[model samples]
Target chain A: MAAHRKRTKGTVVVDTVGIVGLGLIGGSLARRLAQRGIRVVAWNHRPHPYAQAEADGIFCKSTLAELMTAEPDVLVLCNPLKAMPAILAELKPLLDEHPATTLTDVGSVKGMVRNQVKAAGLADKYVGAHPMAGNELSGWQAADPGLYDDALWAVTVDEPTDYRRFFAVASLITEGVGNRIIVLDDETHDKAAAMISHMPHVVSTALINELTANPDRNVAAALAAGCWRDMTRVALTDPDRTRAMVEEDALNVEVLLRRMASRLTDMADQLHAEQDQGSIVRGGSLKGDAAAHIRKFFAAGDPFRRYKAQTSSAGDFPARELEIPEAGWQQTLLFSARRGEAITSFIHPHQAVIQIRPAI
Target chain B: MAAHRKRTKGTVVVDTVGIVGLGLIGGSLARRLAQRGIRVVAWNHRPHPYAQAEADGIFCKSTLAELMTAEPDVLVLCNPLKAMPAILAELKPLLDEHPATTLTDVGSVKGMVRNQVKAAGLADKYVGAHPMAGNELSGWQAADPGLYDDALWAVTVDEPTDYRRFFAVASLITEGVGNRIIVLDDETHDKAAAMISHMPHVVSTALINELTANPDRNVAAALAAGCWRDMTRVALTDPDRTRAMVEEDALNVEVLLRRMASRLTDMADQLHAEQDQGSIVRGGSLKGDAAAHIRKFFAAGDPFRRYKAQTSSAGDFPARELEIPEAGWQQTLLFSARRGEAITSFIHPHQAVIQIRPAI
Candidate 1:
């Protein structure tokens, strides 16, 4: 690709950009950049994705060497965490030969990769970036060309970084792919990611695990609706990645897990206390402190209430009748009111039933 | 409105059905029904939805009485929980004067309302039904029209219920609303709803409440994405109805809550114990036991994983990097593996440094 490019002083104008690993991010970038008149030279480790990319008219190279031989002004790394080190190691010598060229990587975690590059002593020439966008589907076929539009591209620069080369890469990313650039130090980035991204994943995975592990899950699954579906949607995420995330960020995840555990324990203790105090009456009513606690729990901006209302309002169904077979016929009475009408006295459980002759 | 058409037995074929409460379910149902050449007579408690419904060609009824006087062969109940009891009571006497009429309601919990109807001696005329479809949105304008298509409509029939009327209502709902009917007894229906529908709501609500109530919620919220959003989508549910559902089905909801509480506690203990044991070694690798447990939790068919993948794939940027501090370097390492990538044993906590290197 260097053969097709002309270098003037320190500035390299890249006509064709080569992208390795044509997955969701890579494919999307290629499609978008190619549409913007920049030729995209792409390579996928998997032959299927490579064929698919070639068929989509995305410039495809058969091998890493072939990709490098294309001599593009820039090389984009869009591989997995495991493959990133190997790919970087392989490209280091080639990059050394072409001192005029620049390179960037799109990975979710930067600290480790940065260390890897630094260990390999390729820090000045390599920049680490992450585009904050994506979906569940993977592979080049699922890649849309317009994926990076208006997205934040975080570009991390170290103390030894070449300012000219950093700006050159950042400008291309912002102009060709991203909306803006967020320059952060490595430590702040990891902590923020742990709090915002990693911790949430652990929490979500834990919740899903809780639901599936329930002994009464059969019944729970039966009543599962959009709420359950939405809530546990991430539970089906790839187990390996999830496992790796939890393993890698065990400290922050442990903190989150502790908080969740404390809250759950408190809730459980309250429930048990209510049970011990005989607060749960047979007629689906909570009495005394139990009632107050239940009310407080519900009143605390719980989203379940809104979901119930939406689910309830979807169709015209009568309120469910609680069957008290043990308690036989009593004097039952029914008093009906109109919507928006004035309310009279509240009907007590006893008043619900009244002995009376038919209205004549 | 009654003057427009005579109340002949077969003359009142409902070409246009008016829906009063056009929330998520109502709106979706209306849209679907309207697509089938039926005119939707819609009336909301609020007047703001009228213009939007009219723009969508859903003929808005100015008043409830006007809708009642219009005498459509079928009247659907899409109002709120407390409102249903009153509306049904008022409409009971009016319907007694009009022959050849049928009515249905869509309420989440059925036992309480069924008891009210049975006490009022209106069971022979009214058929209670619940359609298992909904989202976090409300109001007539929020209606999607196609919501009920292919969903299951639970039809509750008891001793006092008229089979002929039940079948008629079921047929109309199945053909018109686009959902199949699942016949269930009132007791089974309530229990099933409690386990499946009500319990999920409580779990989701608890999660949201837990997240919101966190002292570090600002951090949690920033880190929140597809997993957190999907898990708490139900948190947008109507508060009042949620309060009632919890109160009325306190027994079942409590049971599920207890289960969730225990599960969460166990996970917390596991994570905490691992931390205490220093199971996360120098390389940031989780011990065999902890890793196995984490893997099992993730592989347990939770939907969160799937949702994460979808969210990660949908937007422009599939992969982005956040630099964590050296202190929190483990967080990035754990979550480094993206979806669709295999797990490899290359993470080195000691080698991991929080440095911003130049882009590749």
Candidate 2:
């Protein structure tokens, strides 16, 4: 809470921050902090990303040693998952030299990263954070300074975390990005993420892959229109990354998929049941029963009738006497007969009845 | 096909046309045809739809008998599935009285309706058609005159179809609405629609329903940007209609769903295999493996790396010669190394990298 603000403020005043991997998040943070007159430096594994970062006037230290020498109050690890461990190892010596400086990571998952950091004996200085924001698009070039505006930044800390260091890190993240911050323990964060982010991707990807593999895909694709495209757009994101996420979180994802599978199986079973019922009604074999069920099911309700009822009120019309025109020998007249009348009807071309009173 | 247009020019003519059911399709057709100097008189089973149609300057007749008295050269049926049979029954007597007139329907399915018409001995006068166009939105109010512009219109006919009647119906349908026409038999048309139109709705709705049902949906919904919203918009369409469409076309829909289930199962199996392999290789579950896999699946090849490779000459920058700065005592240092070569390494706060690289 803001009650610990005073202690963290002093720490932040002494802290200069270093960010590794100047991708979308790291790059955006660098830009925003520099604009706010905060001294921020970044290191990217790729020279071009850093080259572009330097060209964009975001502060970039020529060397990591020089950055460490600047004595940053905090360090933000923004590199990809595969590279983060090596970078962390490389920073161990510097961290031992500057025990006062804190470190945090902006990775999507926290439990694994937190465990690794704890195993490295940097638990007091290291915090794991995730800013729940991103587009399907990636990279520093795609980064916008305003990307984190109004976003939620989840900050995770454990019993080993120094309260002072945690508050200092949380303040910087909230201040730099102007995002609302929520604090959770590492395990809670991972489980929550699996439910929120990880599961949806698996479901979406599976659906897209299924549709793609369908023999009738060409026709379905043409009819895809709005809904189909919207639902599967995420599937078109990095398929490799999606596969990795689902596979890594296989246990949780498997549970979710099982749930989905059950729901689908239930649906299929219900359809089969309905098919049997329809077959009994129509006196047809089970082989053709599904088709009959479908026919009757689709024809059950009038779509227009449903829409009209949903959108309109019966009171919208004024009451009037119902009229039926006389019928000629060659003309077949169509009319709704009232309870008391069985009248002959006649049809006219120009003077057509635009309103008919339903037989009471 | 246009090569024979000269010979068929005067052979086909469409003037006054009767349209039953003034919903989106019927209303749009009336407006478009009116613009093209074709007389269109339409009728709705309900009073308000007719009232609204009349308010929109569409000619609405009170009764089927009145509409038939117009002796329209062609009649267009645009009612819903359940209402179609009864409407057709009422229109039959009128049709028999005027044998010179032709009839066509703009229903979503053809086989069942065509079968019913055949049973009623009205095959000679009816040509089934479906326009592949719609928004998730529905009704006469949502109708746009340009709804059918440049859309595909599938026209189905059989041995009973009059050649002259077919030409006349096709001409009217293609005149200002669809760009091309696909002529098919009744069974093919229904099967194609089941694959394309109905199946997509089922899949899209299922995805939306799954997302909506998630316990962590609050965060997911909050994090849902343009991509999530765009993907699920169609789920907001009439649920009952979507359910009916899928249930009615259960055979086709079941086939599609089964295909999806298999793909999901394969993905899960692959993920489990990878986990087993990783556990054996690394002695325990690899930390961040899932996140890494997800990211990798979605990762495009890094653009900056591609750019650097493309722009650099062989001798430009020796990989081993590159020096990366180590974080000094207090500063947070971030750096990148690719294939054992240091890219850019720097400390945060004092140095920042900023520039624009065109996305390749």
Candidate 3:
């Protein structure tokens, strides 16, 4: 294994970082980095947030070209996904001129962004990252550095991904932003994201839509309590944003949605069987096969339940060192993530201090 | 319209309430009533909470017979659904002797409880009620009077239900507990509850079941944020409790589950079609019929979104009085609830001050 120390203790490989957008994510990242005394240079599509951002110690640039003049060690594309192609096109020549600046993004979908980067011929310098942070609120006005507190990030990599480039983003999340890192391939990241977020958004939307269609919608709405409110909260957010996220990971979201539908249908069939069984299934108890199936359905998620309980009650999870092999470092880290281990810090370029988290 | 005065202004028909089962729901109701200067008598299957309940000014009884001695104006069965039959059987002779007491309950499912009450030959004294209150936590220790603060209750009545009995339970909610009331029949209450709470619980459980079955579950769990947390929160509660609730309201929950499954399946189909349409559905935007269907699906819940926005932003909702025709008063109040009106107070026996809420 080739062990190369990229930076000193308590510091990241990235010094000056260029942020391509000053939206919620980018603005938060810029503010966080500046608060941590790291040099942050950022440019937004509009100049609205520049004053406040500059006052927060971020060097706000008026143009992407101006942002590149800082010659940052890392450039994070935090602009809207719709602006990716145009921004990537503009940044390609500038990135070529400043060859040392590794390209990364805070996009929710990784594989799509990587493909776009490849199309722009900047794949050689690219790494994909998505921070598991944010709130119902958005835009520059809502951006706060605390949004990333104790956040975990999925740093996506591939066979062609440069180790140095991956390390730059990973170290930025780990040391600079003071967050945890879980290494995964782009497909794994997107599929897992769809399972957790994108697919659930569709399900939440379906719930409100169903309620809206019901003849007794007002009665149901009045009866709604914490369960209904919590379950459908995400559906009330901007549908256009959710639609965009789902479509970006359309294939994965579609697959997961079908799987969810199947799960619901199976439960419905079991319940219907219990209903048809009549007196044999008396007093809130099911009969025969339906009983067993219903029990199994509820019991299936026990592992996740236990995991949540453990993590919520846990404080300062114990950490251990994992040696990264250069020949297959990416797989090694991905395997570690599968075991519910998050990289808290890199002791050196080849050794990561991983913390064990409760897993399903 | 027949007008009869039941109580003077600022006074409820119930001066004392007898609560069976001093658990979460019962304990909270007892505490709230006691705090409001109303006499509260309670009995539990266990005597563990007797001391603390008595300390809170509640008259704790060791047996159901002793509880009936209070001669409460309203007798509320706050025990679990499974215990309903046994509790009702024990109280049958007692309730017969204390015929002046109006019977009600805090069960989540109204029809089932009403059926049990009817089977126990106590239908003449029973008025079904389900409070839109509670949290994930349970038991007497977790119970607090604040749980009833600004809560709305569904008071169920049948064609044969006595108006005075319904008024006793209704006034207990409005005046004694300082909560709002919505009158409904057993079927409407059960159906509306299934739509909002029970069906959503199953969907939430199905979500966790799907996640737990996935190979990349830990990856997805690691990437999970607020959406996953909120959507699956109810599933993390006692599975047996959820199973019991679904089974008790089997027919309604079963119907809603199937509808939800169909909605998810439809969305999945549209997403698949968009995928098949190739470059025509470029950059997070759909094309053709699939596009139109997807747009419609997302837009279908707009009314609910608007209603939520309006309600959350508005304060001190304007209220107006509605005359209650005694001949068909039950139907009149049910219609009021369907129109999103909650009874804040009964100005007279035949009139209700209903507060208008945003309707879906």
Best by TM-score: 3
Error of 3 at B49 (Å): 2.0
Best by lDDT: 3
Model 1 residue A200 lDDT?
55
* TM-score of candidate 1 versus the correct structure, residues matched by position: 0.60
lDDT per residue for candidate 2 within B19-118, as digits (tens), equals 8877788778877777766778888887677766666666778898988888888898888766666777787888999987888888776776787677
Worst 10 contiguous positions by lDDT, candidate 2 chain B: B329-338
| Model 1 clashes, total count | 106
**Models sorted by lDDT, best on top:** 3, 2, 1
Q: What are the lDDT figures for the candidates, one per model?
A: 0.57, 0.58, 0.89
Please tell me what DockQ candidate 1 reaches. Answer: 0.13
**RMSD to the hidden true structure, all candidates:** 22.7, 22.9, 3.3
lDDT of 1 by residue, A255-280 (tens): 66566555545555565567677654
The segments of candidate 2 whose C-alpha lies over 4 angstroms from its true place after superposition are A1-15, A50-52, A55-57, A186-188, A279-360, B1-12, B49-57, B157-166, B184-197, B207-215, B225-227, B279-360
The digit string of per-residue lDDT tens for model 3 on B38-147 reads 99999999999999999999999999899889899998888888878888898999989988999899999988888888899999999999999998888999889999
Instruction: Tell me how far the alpha carbon of residue B216 in candidate 3 is from the true structure, in angstroms, after superposition.
Output: 0.7
